[model samples]
Target: MGVTRLVSRRRQDPGTKWARIAMAVLATVGVIDTGSITLKRWGFLGELTCPMGADGCDKVLNSSWGTLINGIPLSLVGLIAYISILLMTLMPLLPGLQENKADLSRRTWWGLFTLSTSMAAFSAVLLGLAVLKIQAFCFFCVLSASLSILLLVLSIVGGGWEDSGILAFRGVLLATVVLLGSLIWISAVDSGRSANVGEKVGVPPAVTNESSIAALALAEHLAVGGAVMYSAYWCPHCHEQKELFGKQASQQLIVVECATDGQNNQADLCRSKRLEGFPSWEINGEIDSGVKPLSILADLSGYQGSREF
Candidate 1:
């Protein structure tokens, strides 16, 4: 008799129906946002122009702090998480999967709570990195974090739990452990990657002499064609671009130092070019930005040489 009454009560819980609807809506938005970022990062889509300005999106995207979990873009992980949340949100509504037993329904609630809580914790850590470490505003990152928080709230209030306090305690414990573990793992990976980049950045231009003569001629042509590579000495990306040219080709290229402390500093010139990012290039009076490949540079400079770099 008691079991039947408990099942009847669970059936009439309004929170279950409303929470399902809310989770579906939130998860859909999350899917679109994270998917767009993932596609862009993977080069399936074009570059994103941040609404906040040029210094906003790319800066955060290119930063060492943004590289999470084995150098994978954080957006990919978010995409998977959002998809999982969406699947879980829809599962309880399926006729065959709906839990008729009261205890099973409680387990489902706990599972949802755990997922949402862990996501929220991770989002909080990302928020901290954005503000304190990266120090840049990213619309996509903020949107993902916001969605995670909303899902967490819905999971808690919409769960319709009789003992909310106990559930809250367990959720907090799970979230804390997940957040700390993630931080430790990410930090270890980041340290190794940073060391590798440091070594690459420190390599002398002489080490790049192995580049072919054709590459040197292309670099010279780019300079004579009124092309300029705007760079800051302190920018790792600028060092990366220079490394691509090697010493001989890089010397022939028209490289402008935009950093105030750099040799032959051209801060005013860079500002006039509206340079807000590192490794911007001016090809025949047209400005193109970011760390461009040598092939693209050859095409832009109209190099008809051997094409061997």
Candidate 2:
């Protein structure tokens, strides 16, 4: 009876159960963090209310450094990582998968260690980019990095390793491969949008008249609603926002140039409004930061225009 009880206990160790729970919780937080960023970047969600300044968040997220593989947002990759971690951590907890739990424990722990360490390594690279390359303070990025570190610590502590040296060696080797693989992937697939040291911000391609009528009408509605576009002449995003309006319609916008020497400059007013990010839209005294689509602008201004953008 004691031996049977011991075998039953080994089948579902209470300690490992707790560890998986902790990891799943952290991974879920990571998912929300990266998932929100991905949605916002894709324009499906409005701008994030970053705890750090909205301008700082926008600058970092929209910067060339944010792209990883062929214009894919780095947040998307992070989203995948977090989801994978969540799924893997939960796998052994399912009733059906519990049959070989003890047998899989060692391998599972090492596998998790490898994944967590890889994430930590990638997070380290991102932290460096946020500090050195982006030179922007992003609260979300920092939070994700903190989560990665915490997850790594949890993995190491929960692994229940028999040999410290073996664990360390495996961790180092796995981390190195992940880091190098990421570097190679980035180099081979980079979109060539790296912020050039002295290059002028390229103008957005002009919008053709073939653009939907709703988009053109939305621009007019924004103007009629006393909407203002606070922008900088050197801001690529500002140009892109203008291009969305097409030529004739864009002419109707009350565009305020925040650059001191820019045409129709309103640098003082922009400063007074505390404008930091380019292409910010102001409607009914509410400022929406970042490049927003015509549909969003229309909805914000309560325009009953056609939905097509």
Candidate 3:
């Protein structure tokens, strides 16, 4: 009789159905946001159009803190998190789960609370990095952080928890854990911080990758064609462009530092060119932005060199 009464009460309890729907919608948006970034990073998609400008988006996404130790994009992690939240949000609403709806709802609410709390905490850490460390703003990152925080708020106010004290305790503990973990992870992956010791403040890390013979020949060809590369010292995509040419080949190309504080800066020249983004290339008096592949550069510059790169 006691078990029957408990089950009956559980079934009659008014769960926040509206909150779940709202969360699902937000999670779906998050999935699309992060998924697109992941695809772009992996070369599955072309250049992404940033809301305000592409410079901040390029710098932040191509920075040292952008990828995991295994070279996986950090956006993929957020994508998985959003997908999990979306699935959990919809699980209890399945028609087949009606018999266990109350029980499932209770369990999934706890899961949502825990997951969203962690996501919110980690997003805070990323936001701090973007503002303080990277000194670049990414609209997508801000959107994800906002979504995480909103989901957290919804999880709290929408859960309709019977025990507020327990929820508070768990939330605190989860947040603390996520905070420490995020700090440690950030410290580990921040190669620029570690490599920049005693160096100029805005200088990018040196490229150590060796260039192939073909790459060197292409670099020479681009130089003869009057192709010039304009870059900012603090831009990771600029560094990436250098890495592609390798140390030896990079020296053969005519490079202009665009950052005002960068060594050998040609700020006046860069401004005259009206450059919109870093790692811009000027071939045949035509300017193009973003990191281009060696083959693309060769074609753009009308290089007849070996295309091995």
What is the per-residue lDDT of model 1 for residues 1-309, given as tens digits with 9 covering 90 to 100? Answer: 444221113544777878878998998999998888777666577666567754456556666655566547778888888888888777767788745545555666666678888888998887787788656688878888899999999887777766656776788899889899878866875676555454433222233445677778888889888789987654557767887887778888888877554567787888688864678899978888778888899888787887777
Task: Kindly indicate the candidate among 2 and 3 with the higher TM-score.
Answer: 3
Taking the tens digit of each residue's C-alpha lDDT, what string does model 3 give over 1-309?
Answer: 343111112333445788889999999999999999999887677777888766577678877788876768899999999999999999988898889888888788888999999999999999999999878889999999999999999988778876677778889999999999999988876754576432666566777889999999999998888899999877767888999999899999999988766688888898799875778899998999888999999888788868898
TM-score of 2: 0.67
Question: For model 2, where is the 10-residue window of minimal lDDT?
Answer: 1-10
User: In candidate 2, which residue pairs clash?
Assistant: none
- The TM-scores of all predictions, comma-separated, are 0.75, 0.67, 0.82
Off by over 4 Å in 3: 1-15, 191-193, 196-198, 209-214, 235-237, 256-280, 285-309
**What RMSD does each model have against the real structure?**
5.2, 7.2, 4.1
**Candidate 2 regions off by >4 Å?**
1-13, 69-71, 181-191, 194-228, 232-239, 242-278, 281-309
